[model samples]
Target chain A: MGKRSFNILDVTLRDGSHAVKHSFTEEQVRQVARGLDQAGVRYFEVSHGDGLGGSSLQYGLSAVDEMKLIEAAVDECEQAEVSVLLLPGIGVKEDLEDAVKAGAKMVRVATHVTEADVARQQIELGRNLGLKTIGFLMMAHMAPVDKLIEQAKLFESYGAEVVYVTDSAGALMPHEVKERVSALKDHLSCEVGFHGHNNLSLAMANTIAAVEAGAAYVDGSLRCLGAGSGNTQTEVMAAVFERLGYQTGIDLYKVMDVANDVVAKIMPRPQEITGSSLIMGYSGVYSSFLLHTHDAAKKFGVDERSILIELGKMQAVGGQEDLIYEVAADISKRNKALV
Target chain B: MGKRSFNILDVTLRDGSHAVKHSFTEEQVRQVARGLDQAGVRYFEVSHGDGLGGSSLQYGLSAVDEMKLIEAAVDECEQAEVSVLLLPGIGVKEDLEDAVKAGAKMVRVATHVTEADVARQQIELGRNLGLKTIGFLMMAHMAPVDKLIEQAKLFESYGAEVVYVTDSAGALMPHEVKERVSALKDHLSCEVGFHGHNNLSLAMANTIAAVEAGAAYVDGSLRCLGAGSGNTQTEVMAAVFERLGYQTGIDLYKVMDVANDVVAKIMPRPQEITGSSLIMGYSGVYSSFLLHTHDAAKKFGVDERSILIELGKMQAVGGQEDLIYEVAADISKRNKALV
Candidate 1:
C-alpha cells in the first residue's frame, strides 16, 4: 500500500483447490480469506471462476460466487487490494468486466512465452476496465532471454502495469532468474514480478534471486499450491523479505499460523527427496520413487537389492494414488522378516 | 589411456554402495565390475568398504572388501586399471602398499581444501609405490579459487598425476565450475579432475560443465549413488561424452541397463525435481520447504497448501530434499476435499 507496494497473494481457495477438484467450500475460502486479511496479505487470487467461468487445466474450479469473492476481496484484504489472474482462451471481455466489478483491483494475464502477443489484447482489456494488469509468460525460460524481453516489453507497452515472469516448467536456474529479471528491468518500463514452479526445487531461491534482482512483486500460492511442482510460497517470501532487511508489513507469525492451519487442513507435507529425486527433477526426467526410498528401506532391510528393486518399481509407485504408506509398510514387512 | 587419459573409474562398489548402504555383494560388485570392465571404463576404484574406515566428513562411505575389491579388480577389469582413494586421517603408508600389492594401479589421496599440504605426504608416499597419485579435496568450494590453485600446485609438486577440482557442495554453477577448474588447470601441470554433489540438482550439469572446462577424468557414481544428494550419474556423463564426440568406450544402452538394474535392485530412483531444484542447489541456500512441501501435500491433502505451508516455513525447511509429489498431492488433496 506504501511506496514499494509489496503484497502477499493467497491462493488456497484458488490454485490449491485445483489439486482436489476445485471443491473448496465457501466456509474454507472464507476462513483462509479472513486469515489472509488478518495476517495482512494484501491480495488474493479468487480462483479462476472468480473471473473466468472455469479453469482450462482444472475444470470445475473457479470463483462462481463473484459476490462472495468480492466480499472476501474487500474483507480479507481490508488494508490491501485483491488480484485475479486470467488465462487466455478462457476469459472474455464480459468476464474481465465482471472481475473488475467483483473488486479485483489488479488483474494478472498469463500466456505462453510465444503467445505474449495474444495477451496484449487482454492487458489492454484489463486496463480499459480500470484494473491494473500484470502481464505473465508461462514457462518463461522455454524461450530465450532476448525473446522473453521482447515479449515482456510487448505486454508492458499495452497497459500492462507489471511484467510477470513465470517459470511454469520449473526448468530455470537461479542465474537465469537474475539474468532475466535484470533484462526485464533494463528493457521494460514496468515493474517486474516472478512466479516460480517447484519442479526444480528452487522456487524459493529463484524468488529470492528475482527479488534481489529487482522483482517488485512475487506471486506464490498460499502454500505454494498450483500446477506440477507448485508455485512459490508467499509466506516463505515474506520471511525472505524480512531477513533481507525489509519490513514487509506482513505479520509473519500470524500469516504462517494461518498458512499452516490452511495447508494442514488442506494437505500433509510432501516427501523430502534427495539423490535420485533431485537427479530426476534436474534431468527433466521422471520415474516415480517420490518418498518411497525411506519407507521401502524401513520395510525391506535397506539392502542394495531392496533399494534397487524399489528404484526400478518407483515409476509404478509414483502414479499409484496415495500409496506412500502402504509401500513403506510392504517394504517394512520384508525388512522386519529379514531382521 | 590416451594423453587426456579417458579413464572410466568404477567407484560403484565404493560410492554407489554408500547410497544403498554397504550392501554390495561380492556378486553385485563382480557383476558391475565385469560389465564395467567389458564396457571399458578407464579406472576402477577398488572398494574401500564405502569409506567406513575413514571417519571425518572428509571420507564418505568406505566399506567394500579391499582384498575382495582387489580380487574383483584383478579378475574383472581386463584393460581398465585400478585406483584406491586415500584419505589423510584414515589410511597409512602400509594401506597404500597393501592396495598396490593387491594390484591397485593408482591411488587418489584426498583432503579437505585446508589440508592440501597434508596430502603432499600421502601423494609422495603413494607415488613411491609406483602408483599414479591424485590429490582430491572433499569440499573444494569452501576455499576460494586462489586457494584451490595453491592446493593444486602443492599436490602437483608432490608428483600428483592429477589435481581434482571438487565441488563437494554441488554449490558451483556451470560458470563457476569452469572458472574453478580452469584456475586449477592454470596453476598445475597435471591433469585436472572433478567431482560434484547433486544438492542443486546440477550434478550432471556441473560435471559436464567441468569436463567441458577441461577436466580429463570425471568422477561419478553409478546411478548417482553416494552421500547426501549423491554424485553425478556416470551413465549421464557417458551420454554427454558420447554426444560430445569423445570416446568413452561406454555402451550407453548397456550402462543404462546396468544403472537401471543396480538402482532397481538396491535403490530408489532419485526424485525428479525440475528447475526450482537446480536454482536452490545453485543459490546454495538451504530450506526444508522443498522436501516438506511435496511430502506434506500428500500427507495433508492439498499440494498447494502444503507447498505454501512449507514455503511459509522457509526457515523451517532449510535444506533441499525431494518434494515434487508432496507439492502436487497437497494441492490436489485440498482441491478435492474443499471443492
Candidate 2:
C-alpha cells in the first residue's frame, strides 16, 4: 500500500541470450554488457550459455564455457555485479569453487524443493568462499508454500543470501503471486527473488506481484529467453518497479536497445502470445505451453489450426491437459466433430 | 477470498478481427461464432464491422457495415448474445438501435472517462429499447481511479447492465486491476467487466487479477487482438479462468483452429509492444497500442528491423516509453550509447 520497493536482477546475457539461441558472440556479450551495466541493473546473471550441471557437451550450459562466460562478466560488466546460475547436481563442489574463482561475484543454486538440502550444502560452500549465494526452487508454484518456506529456511541456514519464487510453468496470476509471496516473505531472512515465465503472459505482472508482496529481487531475461516462454523480462519488470515508486537501478531503454541490436540477431524473436501458449494458459496446464498445445492437438484428433485458436482460450483456463481433455470432452459431448 | 469469482466475457470476434484487418468474411464470422458459442463464453462482443467512428473511417466503423456484420452474426453466431461495441462521439444512437434490432442482444458504449457521460446517454437509449447495455470507460488507466469510479456510477444509475474496467492502454498491473475493480464494484450495481490490452504484456494477468478481485466477466480478443500487445485473448483468459477453478465457455483447441487457418490469413499479425507504446506506457500515457505499434512501424521508422525489435521490448515494459527516454537520457548524460 505504501510506496512499493524491490530490486531488479537482470539475467539477460545468461537467460535473455536464450531468446537469441544461447549463442552470444563475445562481441555481442560485450555490447550488451556495456548497455546492461549502464542501465543500472544491479545484477547480471552470467550463465554458462548452456544450462548448468550438464557438461559443456550438453546444449545450454555447454554452449558457452563457464570460465569464458565468467571471465567476460568479470572483465566487461561493472555496476551490475555478475552472478552465475547453477542447477544443483549439475555441478560438483569443485565446479562451484572453480566457478567463483573465475570471477563470479555470486552463485545461485537451483533444485527442486526436495533437493533443497543438497542445494543448501553447495550454498554454504559458496558463502564460505565469500561468494553471495542464492537458492532457486525450480517450480515454486508446484511446491506447496509451506514446502518452499521450509526449504528456504534450510537454504538460509546454509548461508543462502537469497531464495526465489519461480513460476516455472507460467501458471500463476498476480493474486496468486501476492498470496504466495506474502506467505513466503514471513519465513525467510534472506532476500526473496522471483523468476517467472510468460507462457500465460503474466511474467511482468507476476514479477511485479512478487515485488509488491515483498520480494527483494525479481529476475528477468533480456528478451524473456530461457526454457519455453522464457524468464521474466528484466527491462519490463524494472519499469514496473520504477512506476511503483521504487528505484530498479536499471535503464530499461538501454536494455531494449540491446534486444534490438544484439539479442534479435542471435535468437528467434520471442514467439508472441501465440495460440499454443494461450491455449495452454486456458487449459490450466503447467506443462511447456508449446509442447502441450502440440500434444493436445494430436490427442484431440483436431488439426493444428483448430488447436491454435483454442490454445489462447485454453491459456485462460489453465490447469492440466486433463482440463483440455475435459473441455474437449464437453465440447464433443455437445457436438461431434465440432464442425 | 470467497471462492475467487471471475467472469469470462468473450470478445474474440470484435477485437480479434482487428488483427485480421477487421475483415471477417461471413464464413469466418460464422466459423468463429459456432466455435465460440459451444465454448461456453458468457458474452459475445461482436463488432459492427463498420469502420471506426470519428476520424479514422477505415479503422473503426467504416471497417464494417453494421447491418451486414449483424446479419452475419445472426446467421453465424447463436451461442453467445452479441455485445456490439460503439465508440461514443464517433457514431450516433441510430446505429445503436439499428444494431440491437438487427439481432445484437446488447450494446456497449466506449469513451474516455471524461467522456463517460456522453456514452451514458446512448446506453440509456439502449436500455429504453429493452436492450441490455454496458458503459465502457475506455483508457481507464489514463483516468484517475477515484474519478473513473464516479463515472462508472453514473452509468449504473442510467441502467447500464455492466461497468467495464477497460485498460485500453494495457497499462494497469494485476494489483491495479484488483484495486480498480474492487473500487468500482463497491459503488456499482451492475456486473464489472474487464477489457485489456497487451502493451505491457499483462493482459491475461490483469484480466485474471480482475477476476480475483471479484469481477464477474473477463473481456478479451481471440489472439490478444485489438490495440497494442493486442487484447486479452479469449482462449487465453478462458484457460486462465479454468485454471483458477472457474468457467469461461470457450473451446480451447477449436478456437485455435479458426484463429490459425482463417483469422491468421485474414489479418496480418500485429507486431505488438513497440518503442512509442513503451514510451507512452512508461510516461503513463495510454494510447492506442495497435495503432501505435504496428501501424506506425508500417508508416514511418528509423529502421524497420530496429523499430520492430524495439517495439517488442517496449511492450514488454508496458508502454512505458518515458522510462525508456529517461534511461536513454541518463545514458546520454553520461556520454555513452546504450548498446
Candidate 3:
C-alpha cells in the first residue's frame, strides 16, 4: 500500500491545559511551542483548554490570559501554523478575532455534537477572517452516523476546511470509528479529521482506524496531555505512523525528546487510565468531565462513578460542567434518602 | 453483527512477571489468581516471564519457583483453569510435567513465529499429559501470513488445541492483525489465539481486530505488566469488550479494582510507551529485549535504539539476551573507532 498523508494538529497547549487546570503560563506555552516547532510539528494549537473565552471561573481560570499564551506560541512556532479552538457560546466573533490578531493562523470552531448549528456563525466568521477553519464536533459519540453526517454537513456548509469526528468521550470503538469516519469521508466534500482521547486506552487505535477510513487530519497532544487519560501522545502517534510506512513529516526522535524533556516536566501527573476515567469512557461521558466529576463527587460525598453515570445518563456535553455539581448533589441527596 | 464469544487468557502472572524481573512470589500469584477467579476469569496463566524453565541466569531467576507459583494459583483459583507457558529452547518435558503436577490444567508451548517446529515436542508432551495444549508463535509480526498459517498447521499437527499469532513485540497493526488472524482462522483446524504487547500502544485495538477476524483466545496482563510498555491491561480489555457489547463473563469493576489495588502496587514503573519500547515495536524486536537492551546500552555506553535496530537486522528472537550485550559492545566499539 502507498504511504498515506495526514495532518497532525497538535492541541497540547490548548486541550492539554485542562490537565494542569488551565494554568499554562506564557513561558510554558513558548517552551512547548518551541519544542513542537523544532520537532517539525506543522500545526500548533494554542488557547484555553476549553477554547477561546474559557479562562473564566466556570472552566477554571488561566494563570495567564490565553491570548498571551497564543501570542507566545505564535512567537516561538515560527515555522508551524498556530491555531486556537473557539466554542460557539464561550467564544464569539470578537474572541476569534482577538485570537487571529494574536497570530493564530487557524481556528477550530467547536460545538456539542448535536449542536453543530451553534457553530455555524463562528466557523463563518473564522473563514471570513482568513483563518484556516476546522469544525470540531465535541462529544461526537453521542450522535449516530446519520446525525454525525448531518452535523458534519453543517460544518461543510459553513466552509469548514475540515470536519472532525471528535471522540470527545473516548467512547467510540474502533469499528465505530471506522464506520463514522468512512461515512463522513464519503459524505463530506471537506477533509475529515479525528480527535481521540485515551480514556479507554484506545486513542492510537481509533486514530489509526480513522486514518485508514480516510481521515486527513488527526489531533493529538504531546505526552497525551489532555483531559481524562489524555489525547493520543503525538510522539507515539508519529512513531506508529512511521512504522506503518506513512510519512508524518515529523522527526520521530525530536518528538520523543520534546515529550520527554518538555512535556513530562509540565505534567502534573503521569496520565494513566484511572478508574473514573475508564468509567467515563465506558459510560460515554465527556472526557473533560473527569476532573469535574471527581471534584463534585468529593464535595457532595457521593461516589464519582455515580456522578459519572448520572452525567452520562443526562447526556452532558462539553459546556455542561455546572450540571456535574447539580447531578452530584442530587445523587448525594438520593443516597442519603436510601440510607 | 452478532456479538462474538472469544476466550480471554489472563496472563498477568505468567507474562507480567517480566516487569517485576521474574520475581513474583507464590503469595502474589495466589492473590492475583483469587482475584481473577472471583472476577469470573476462566483462564489463569502462571509461570516465569520467560516461560516454564526461565528461572535461570539468562532469563533472571524467579523469587519463588514457578512450580510453586502455579501451584498457588491453582489452589486459589477455584473456578479458573490454571495455565502455564513453556518456550521450546528454555523449557523441556520435565518442566511441563512439573507444571502439570502443580495443577496447571493448560500449557501454551511457545516458539519464535518462524520456528514453530521447536514447539512440537512440548505440544505433544502437553497433549499426552491431557493438558489443553496451545501453540504460541511469538513475535508473530516477523512472519508473513502464509508462513504464519504454515506454522499454525505445524502446531495443529503436533496436537495443539489452539495456535496463537502472538504479537510479542506489539508491532502488528490492526489491518495486519485482521489479515493474519483471519488467515489463521481460515486455514487452521483448531482455534486461533492472540497475545498482544502494548509497545506501540496498539494492543487492545489489535486484539479487537484479531477477535473480529475470528481469533478465539486473546491474552492480556493485568495493568499491562508484561515486557516493554507491557501487554494490554486486562481491565481495559475487559472494559472495552463489555463496551463493545461482548460478554466476557467477567466483572469490569472487579478487574479494575484488581488492577488498581493489587497490580499497581507490584508495578515497578507504570507502563507507558517509551522510546526503547516503541523501537521494539517499530523494529519488530522481542518485547522482553527492552530491558536487556537498555541494560546493555547503559553498560556499554551505546544507544539502545541502535542495539534494537541491529537486533532487528539479525532477527533476534527470545532467549537471545546475550546477543543484546554483544551488539551493544560492537556498536560501542564502532562508535569509538569513528571518534
Best by lDDT: 3
lDDT of 3 by residue, A1-339 (tens): 758799888998988988999988877888889989988999979888889999887788989988888888889876899999998778777888888889999999888889889877888898899999999988888988999999999999989999999898788888899999999988988999999998788999999989989999999998889988899889889888987788898987788888888888898887888787788888898656878888998999987887887788777776799999999999989999999
Pairwise DockQ winner, candidates 2 and 3: 3
Q: Write the per-residue lDDT of candidate 2 for residues A1-339, one digit (tens) a residue.
A: 447556677777776655555566666667767777777776777765433444444344345565676677667766768888777656777777777777778888887654688776778778887888888876566566777788888888888888887776676777778877887788776788888777777787788778778898788876565556677766566556666677765666777676555655566655565664554343334443345555665666555434434544444232354555554445444556455
lDDT of 2 at A12: 70
Query: What does the lDDT read for residue B258 in candidate 2?
Result: 58
**Tens digits of lDDT, candidate 2, B97-209:** 77767787877787776567777678778889787788888767766689989899888887888888888666786678999999988987789988887766677778777
Task: Give the DockQ ranking, best first.
Answer: 3, 2, 1
What TM-score does structure 3 among the candidates reach? 0.90
Better of 1 and 2 by lDDT: 2
* lDDT at A189, model 3: 89
The Cα local distance difference test for each model comes to 0.64, 0.66, 0.87
Tens-digit lDDT track of model 1 for A109-179: 88877678888788888888888788977757657799999898889888898988877655566678889
- Against the true two-chain complex, what DockQ does each candidate achieve? 0.03, 0.31, 0.57
Tell me the deviation in Å of residue B12 in model 1: 5.8
Note each model's CA RMSD in angstroms.
13.9, 7.1, 3.6
Candidate 1: interface RMSD in Å? 9.6
| Regions more than 4 Å wrong, model 2 | A1-5, A48-50, A53-66, A92-98, A173-176, A274-339, B1-6, B20-23, B48-66, B251-267, B286-339
